[model samples]
Target chain A: MQGAITIEGVDKRYISRGRETVALDSVSLNIQPGELVSFVGPSGCGKSTLMNMIAGIVPMTNGRIIHNGKKVSGINRDVGYMTQADSVLPWRTVEKNVALPLEYRGVRTQERKQRVDEMLKLVELEGFNKSFPRELSGGMRKRVALAQMLAYSPNTLLLDEPFGALDAQLKMVMQQQLLNIWREQKKTIVLVTHDLSEAIAVSNRVVVLSGRPGRIKHIENIDIPHPRDVFKVRFLPEFERAYDSLWEQLSSEITKGESL
Target chain B: MQVDESAAVGTGLNTGGSSKAVLAYEAGLEQRKMMVRVSQVLFAIVFLSFWQWASGRIIDPFFVSSPLAVGGRLYEWTLNGQLWSHLSVTMLATAFGFFIGAGIGFALGLLFGKFAFLAEVMDPFITALYSIPKLALAPLFIIWFGIGIESKIAVSASIVFFVVFLNTFAGVRDVSQIYIHSTQIMGASNWAVLRTVVIPSATAWVITGLKVSVPYALVGTVIGEFMSSNRGIGYIIAQATGLFDTNSVFAGIVILMVVGAIINGLLKKTEGWLLRWKE
Candidate 1:
């Protein structure tokens, strides 16, 4: 009854300054409905490259990405893609920023205006609708970004380090907000991050990636309940075991990526 | 990254966020407070008083008119409506030149920005001519268009074109790659991407160019008028110089200065309205 994302043996490469570098190699995954999956590795791990493929920001080198049953070509409007930076335009008001997609899709003005109201209320940005991005705190801007992404009610949410810019405390708060939104909306969410603890905190399943031409080393399902408090659950034996297992499998690949 | 702002209602100050980013706010306030009203008034008073004292006691009136005499002549010319008609002529030439030049500059800038090949190929020629003194070509312009509005308009447009074109090109080229990637992921068509991302992002550059070109338009028109025209404030100054009518010369100079200030004010007002987001 719900949508799923299927990656079929995808490969990606980038040619920069006359050097051809393979980014992803024969990566395949099946993310089911209501799934919160995270990809974790060091820099240039191709976590971002894989996310770009699913989001269709970059063309696949040698594979197919299917959202639901149809093949994705360029960008998929039915999916929300959030990047590491630049999720908002500074010129747009906070409310206008949130309602950008709806505006672009040519939603009726009246209906869209009402949705803007609903969105601002949902993001707790009701009174700050007129405020610009520069006026808002870093945390507030991220919430606005999340609200904007949620406005279209996409079936899939692709996050590329949504909390990368925030401080540690702020990142925790954002993770909780994201968890709450997922609980209510039940969108199939895929997050890419370098932080191992963050990957385990909010995701239903954590996919560990080997650096450089990234491939999944391990996929560990948390089997934990929703709204899991990281502060309380993070210290448990199960969490420690899962973290070690991922580190053990990824340690060599991380070194390999760094040396190259 | 949701702020717990529900607890911060009516706080009146973002003390927490302000404390977190003091340098950004402090530098912003410093820029805003840079416009010194008192210094401006004092400088104006000192300059006029010095003009009056120097002309009345020591300096030759033929070279530098007294402030009082200049004021009186300005008052007389204004009452007879000579200044208004001349001001109107200058204004029309400036406005026409600015619009046409700015319009073309903006379009060409966008083209050059989007097409790197065109920019690379044409940039050398643009740079070579941009470095050349445009005023030297005034005689050619005068001979071609005659001593009329067209010559002034052509001069004004020529000077402003380089200023605006370069700015628009830089602005477009300066747009964040993040925005482009985000828009592409949003499924925006090429036209939509250009309209939403390219133009708005480059507007800051275009506005910067506009500020620089406002005075450029005036200088081009005034230079053209000085070279060949029989009307405008430039004509008044040129005529007054021959007769040693220092008061009239001073009056014309004062009129040009004030007119320049007023036009700058108008340009700033327009920029503020369009770029309220910066605030």
Candidate 2:
């Protein structure tokens, strides 16, 4: 596909107080256009670092990333990013916050409202357009954040554990909603999450990374068909095999990661 | 303490248990409000009557003016229109100084907040100047702007500038880094980030700064008038002091207190309106 992202031999290092910390080492991956891929790993595995690089918000220590056909540079505005923390502007109402990306794109006022209204409906937040971020529940706020990310119709999405903070039931609901949206929009999504079941439920492929100075431990294909029910996916035989194999690799890394 | 409805019903204290509890709680609240009102009125009456008695007895009336004398002086000023003439001058000076100082301070504060390197370079100088009492600059202002309201405006602006500057600076600096990042990811330019995120976040702090500096602005105006002015409330107080007219001084002080209280109440109302979203 034309809008594919190729991450080649990317490495990231952090230097603070005369100390060196290697966050990612010789990491490489290829994400096809319209594919939903999850980077599943233990904490400190540099999943977030990889997401940042893809978004072009952070510089890598070495190697490069190609977005669409161009080399990724400062702030790849072609992609939408959703972080673990709800980053909705508290001062803005729901509709206004969601319309931010559209506003940044210089979309006109009337068009912005129409687009925001549609997005709010998609997220089931039609009536909450005037409510401030502080007034919304956690799930509702996450919906707003998701709506914000999708507002500008970006070609790709870089989600760094966007639903990690949610409870299990909410997470499942969000996953189902995300799947529904993905089916409709068909944008390339690169998700960073430590939740193994979450990776299997939503993503077509799960890339498992090792501990600190993270390396690709394994990449598993989840053959579960689209329009899959997230609530019932775990009961499937295909899902069981995918889970067992991925968990076997991930648990070892988790133990090793914890020791560090 | 509240008794839960189901628990109270189980104990058979009252069949309409929850409603009764709610009624009792509401009654208690009303009783408290009445008590507060009674105490306030009683305290005011007792204090004013004691001051009316003590001014000429325990304390010399020449030093501490009696309440009755102060009241009479206020009545005399009101009847002759002297109070309005002096009060208008002070109010005009204070309003001019407050707006001008607060405006300039807000503008520069936003500029400095966005440009950290510039703020850092000017930090020591700004702090040094801010530390010096604004009243000390009154004579210099008088020399530059003369004894008119211009001098008072300059002095009040100087005082208000630092208060607002410090508040706006801290508010802008303290905006969450995550929020900024999120805005940028949505393809926002630096200017867009400031407009949508920084300004709104810092508004509360800026308003707080404005509210806090109101009294200081008044102080600067009064001090300027006290130094040298032909007409103002401060002039009235200065004149009373010169003549040892304690009652006039007391009246001037009471007038100032009333003005300050009204201004403070208005400011609080404005703050509540602006930050209503926070609730």
Candidate 3:
């Protein structure tokens, strides 16, 4: 069976101003196909760095990432990444922004048009095809961004704290929306989030990472059912147990980062 | 600002799909447009009336010619077709110079912006040329290219080229990293990313530069005319000044201002049409 993602002996290092900074050290993890995984820890745990490697955006200093039994070299069309900022093209309307990937891949006129239309509907932005990004609210822009990423129908999604900037209401709404979209598509998702609660709310498994030169501190398999409720997540005894356990592990990582 | 209201209404009507509502909306828009025009007319009358009165009684007509005298001079020139010929020459020179200069400037900006080494090599030469009074070299342009439209076009184009080049260079260079990352994640090739991501991002800057350069082209033409041209509004102004015809000078300046306004208005409209994506 082809695992969705297999990271073997991965080490990520960045050399800046002649000082070598090891972002990740021999971090190894395996993501099963269709697994919704969250990389969670204190800030500077290199969650984003590891996600970047999985998506082939950042080259690992050592080791390799294999997606579908193929060693990834550069950007693979099957992977879709949504970073912290919703960098929707200012020039394109909502529909056009969603259709960007298809356009670049030379998806034919009729099919691309239909996919754009369908994606807009999927993201509940059916009527916002012509609205520019500036005209959109932050939450609405984020939705457009989600629509754009989902438009390409990528088999895997790497999201870097996409809901980090939103108001609480919008964030919860987006978390649910992402879950619903994930339910519909069942793509392998690697989400990097600092909010431990958000990680627990969405992911099938939460990987707690250590401080700088991040390594997996703890891996807890979430037994939560699909169509999970963010509001009810905190009340679940299992949720509290997992969160408390992860916090205990993460506390020292954050403290170590500050001390350094 | 009112233009924005109608646009919102237009958007509202588009999704509503009610024919009667759209028809009523269109009629309402027309009414607003008529009211706008009427207000403009009233404002123009109030201002011009004050001007005419001031020139006739409050101020010396010698210092500031009465609107009537200028109108009469404009009428005489129009009847004799002197205004038409002179205006055409200036218009021709301005149009040709504007296109050539804008074209060259835009191309160079894109090239230099894309290639940093090229930009570095050309920076000193461009800066040196930019600082020199473009008009001061008009006589030399005339000597090199002669008294034809070629000289005028060259002079105007040289003036316009630098401004547009600088703006376009900035526009292209400032392509957002976020957008680039987004495109890269989408697996966009270098050329595809440049065309879709880079070019659109920089269009607002390029368009702004072009709009400013439009009037610069006219200045170039008029400057060239001051030095050597036998036609154009600049040529007419030179003749009028030789004979101390201040009225004609005012008339030429007035006409030039009007043309400049019309060109700017057109450019703004084109920007509205094309760069509607710009915030």
How well docked is model 1, in DockQ terms?
0.39
Ranking by lDDT: 2, 3, 1
Tens-digit lDDT track of model 2 for B55-115:
8789999999888999999999999999999999999889988998888888889889889
TM-score of chain A of 1: 0.94
Which candidate should be chosen as best, given TM-score against the real structure? 2
Candidate 1 residue-wise lDDT, B97-186, digit = tens: 898889899999999999999999998899998997777777888999999988998888888888999999999999997787776666
Query: lDDT by residue for model 1 over A64-165, one digit each (tens)?
Result: 988977798877667888888866988888877877788778889898889988887876777788888877776677778888888888889999998888
lDDT of 3: 0.85
| Model 1 share of native interface contacts | 0.34
Q: Candidate 3 regions off by >4 Å?
A: A1-3, A225-233, B1-65
In angstroms, give how far residue A226 of model 1 lies from its true place. 3.9
Q: How many pairs of residues collide in each model? A: 1, 0, 0
Least accurate 10 contiguous residues by lDDT in model 2 chain B? B1-10
Q: Which stretches of candidate 1 lie over 4 Å from their true place?
A: A227-231, A235-237, A258-260, B1-42
Best by DockQ: 3
Q: Score residue B98 of candidate 1 by CA lDDT.
A: 92
Q: Each model's C-alpha lDDT?
A: 0.84, 0.89, 0.85
Better of 1 and 3 by TM-score: 1
Ten-residue region with minimum lDDT total, candidate 3 chain B:
B1-10
Stretch of 10 with least lDDT, candidate 2 chain A: A131-140
